[model samples]
Target: MLTILAAIAPNFLLILLGWLLRARHVLDGPFWLQTEKLTYFVLFPALLVTNLAEARLDGLPVAAILGAHGLGITLVLGLLVLPLRFLSPRLRADGPAFTSVLQGAVRPNTYVGFAIAAAIWGPHGVTVTALASSLVIPLVNLYCVTALIRWGSGGGKRGLGATVLAIAKNPLILACVIGAALNVSGIGLPPIVGPLLKILAQASLALGLLCVGAGLEFSALRGAHGPVAAVLGLKLAVMPLAVGALAWSFGLTGTTLAVTVTYAALPVAANAYILARQLGGDHALTAAIITASTMAAAVSLPVVTLLIGYLP
Candidate 1:
């Protein structure tokens, strides 16, 4: 128990530090935005490319990871969208944005997941999970962006082709794809390229999480408690537990199992909220969900970490 607690304590402290810095106005919005952009557009992609470029995906339990992640998300999406489909006309207007917020609440924050993965499982685990995320992120973002845009646009007739094109143009997804290709092809980046990417990847964890904390909208959290509760319950508890069971059923163990479950358990990403607001989705509801789930994960993560330690 103490080992598990010790492993997770540093991550929780770093997030709290991020929140404190933002609360104290030590990190301003423009700075946070620029940092987040750099992380998203440059650092994270570079990291993914670098880490995954040399990975061997053979015998990696890719199916289990994919199954756990996909099934959990599919179930949560249906649960969120069905009830939202019946809201009043006026309230129904907010349904798409509201559903987008729910997606954001349930989606895991890969930045935080990466940081904790490195701390608990070291370089090898980081490399492997980076590889996993390189695959997972593109698909996840594609679904999220499409859902948010479609709903926010009132289900207007935008072709699926257009959505695919839009997702294809996303820089983050592009980077992940390129990285995964390099990994599968067994190509080695030039020495200079690898080092540069490594530096950015290292910086991404702290900088990204700090920007995430800075972006948390306390004002939006007010008057959204009931919806926030439903979102948080599914995101922090249900989703992770579901993933854990799937992982066990498949006989996954060691760091793969630990990282997989922990990744599943991460709070709804801050980016989800940002994307929601940008696309006319319910920013306040997204904000409420992100903030509430992130705060709750501080407790839930430790519990899951301990559970993983006990797994056969």
Candidate 2:
């Protein structure tokens, strides 16, 4: 237990450090925002490409893992969607707030997932995570975009074709596809390029965690307790338990099971608030869900690790 906690402690500590930095105003808002953009557009993609390009992919159960993970997320989405039909008229009438609930229920923070996977399972874990991200990212984006468009106030203004195109051009997805291609082709990276990518990849972990910290906003939770609590329960508790069961049933074990569960247990993505704001959803509620889920994960994740340790 101590060993598992020891592994995850530093990653969360980095997040805490980021929160401290932001709280102290050591770095201004624009700096953190730009840092997030750089990390997302450049550093993270470099990490994915370098890791995936070098990964030994011969024997991994790529299909089964993707299938099981996708199924798990789909089930969660279905469960969350069902409740919307039964919500109070007042709650149901609030399109933005409902959209916030939906986003919180489904989005997983891959930045934190990467940091945790690398810390717990090393390179092989990262390889599996990258692969999982390739499949999961597009799937979640499709669903979230659909929900935003269907239920958000200005969602109708955004064309489906444009949303699809934007997702297609997402840097992270592009990185995964290109890296997987390189892995399969066996062309690998040039010697000079590999070292440069390595440096960017290393920079991503700390910076990414810090950005995640800086993005946290707890003040929004006050007025939105009910919905926020529900989202947090679904995101941090229900989703991981459900996904872990599915992974086990699919015969995943060791690092594969561990990484998948960790990924599932991640908080709502920071980008959820952005999407909510863009589409006229309840951005405040979305931000609160992100903050609450992230804080909850510090405890939930270690408990999850301990549970995985006891699994056969």
Candidate 3:
């Protein structure tokens, strides 16, 4: 238990610090916008590109891990979509919006997951997890975008070409593709290039977390507790459990299994709201779900750590 707490303490501390910074108004709106832009458009992509470019590809159960995480997420999302009665009139009004919000709630936060992996399992773990994330993030983003757009936008018809364009144009996806190409080509990063990438990768997590914390809100969840809790349960509990079982069934054990399950247990990506809002989904509800799931992950992540620690 002590070891588990020790592994997770840093992440929780960062969140608390970000919260405190917001409480003291150290982060203004413009600062947050800039921070988010830098994190998403530059730091995150650089991190993904660099980490994945040099990842060791030998003997990794890459497919099984990615499949397990995706399957777990899909199942949880499907279950969350089931129609439910909200007795509260206020909640009833917000319920549809909550569905889109909840989609973001169930997806893992890759930045935080990679940071935790580094702390818990060292640099090798970081590289492996980053590679896994490179595969996961684009797919998850597409899923969220598709779901929120279809559900919240009142069934607007979208062309497949536009969807493909969106995926192609996403900075994160583009970074991942470039990284994979570099990795497969067997050309090592040049001297200056490696350091430059490392600098960006290192800054990605802390800055991203700070902006995420600054964006957290309680009022969005106040009257919609039931749906929020439901999303949290699926995200923090159900998804990890499903990932563990599916990963085991597919013959993934040891570090691969540990990484997959731990990441699956991570909170929804903080950027989910930004994406939803950008693409015309329910922004307020997405914010609420992001806030609730992130808080719950403080507990859920430790539980996953213990599970992985005890793995045979």
Best by TM-score: 2
Q: Give per-residue lDDT, candidate 3, residue 57.
A: 81
- Count clashing pairs, candidate 1: 0
TM-score of each: 0.89, 0.95, 0.90
Q: Which lDDT values do the candidates have, in the order given?
A: 0.74, 0.84, 0.75
lDDT, candidate 3, 1-312, per-residue tens: 787689778877787787778778887678788888899999999888888888888878778877887777677656544343244354356534754555654667887888888888887778767776776777777777666555555323455567668778999889988888888898755589878988988899888777777778877887657657767877788778887889889998777778878888888887777766655567777777888888888887887878687877
Worst 10 residues of 1 by lDDT: 82-91
Name the 10 consecutive residues with the lowest summed lDDT in model 2.
81-90
RMSD in Å for model 1: 2.6
Positional deviation of residue 280's Cα in model 2 after best superposition, in angstroms: 2.1
Compared to the true structure, candidate 1 yields what TM-score?
0.89
Candidate 1's residue-wise lDDT over 1-312, tens digit each? 776678767776777777788788887667777888898888878777777777667788878776777776666667654465455343366665566555764567888888888878887678657765765677677667666656765323456676677678877778777877776667766688788887887787777777777777777788887678767777777777777788778777888888888888888887776666555677778887888887888888888888778877
- Which residue ranges in model 3 land beyond 4 Å of their true spot? 78-102, 154-163
lDDT, ranked from best to worst: 2, 3, 1
Off by over 4 Å in 1: 79-84, 87-93, 153-162
Tens digit of per-residue lDDT, candidate 2, span 135-168:
8877887888788888888877878888778788
